[model samples]
Structures are given as C-alpha cells and as structure tokens.
Target: MKLKVDYKKCEKAGECYYNHNALFERTDNGFPKILVEDLTTDALRHEAAEAIEVCPTGAITIEE
Candidate 1:
C-alpha cells in the first residue's frame, strides 16, 4: 500500500501527526509531512488508514 496526501486540501489539523508520530510528522508551519511512503507492513497499512479517517479535510489517501 501507498500513502498519499493532497497538500492543497490539507487543513493542517495535525491529527495524523499527533496520533501517529512515527509515520507522520508536523512541519514548522503545522502541516503534516509523511515520514514513510510505501506501507510494506500490515501495521503501517492499518495506521495509514486510521490517519486518513481522522483527517478532517480528507487529504490523506491510501492506494492499495
């Protein structure tokens, strides 16, 4: 699986970073930066899905 972000649609809510710091990081301006690209492990896939769901702007997407 792959994780993608729509930067234009991102609201910088920080939910993904807050919930999954290992997979996502917050920029100085508070935007979410993806720490990992391809989710090769099951754990990462699950976490990515959770982040996508928590994102209020629906900016995060999972490509399977």
Candidate 2:
C-alpha cells in the first residue's frame, strides 16, 4: 500500500506533516510534501493511517 494525498481536497491544515513527519514534509507554501510514497512496513502503514485520520479535509488515503 501507498499513501496518497489529493491536492485538490487539501487545505494546508498541516496535520499530516505536523504529526507524521516521517512520511511528510512542509512545503514552502505550507502544503504537505509527501516523503514516502510506499508503505513499506507495518509501522509506516500505521503512521499513514494516523495521518489520514487527522486530516480535516480527508485528503490523505491509502492507495492499495
């Protein structure tokens, strides 16, 4: 599985990057920059889920 973010649905809330920095980074414009595309481990998958749940706009999802 991989973590995917829908840019059109994102509102730059910073929740993904702020809480899940291992998988994301903050762009200069405050948008989230995905640091990992692949959910290579159970840890990563769990982290991605947390990020997705925290996203207010529900922009993050798991791409299987």
Which of the numbered candidates is closest to the native, going by highest lDDT? Answer: 2
Clash pairs for candidate 1: none
| Error in Å for residue 39 of model 2 | 0.2
Q: Estimate each model's TM-score.
A: 0.93, 0.97
How accurate locally, in lDDT, is each candidate? 0.91, 0.94
Please state the error at residue 28 of candidate 2 in Å: 0.5
Clashing residue pairs found in predicted model 2: none
Off by over 4 Å in 2: none
Model 2, 9-53: lDDT tens digits are 999999999999999999999899999999999999999999989
Q: Best-fitting candidate, measured by TM-score?
A: 2
Candidate 1, superposed: residue stretches over 4 Å from native: none
* Clash tally, candidates in order: 0, 0
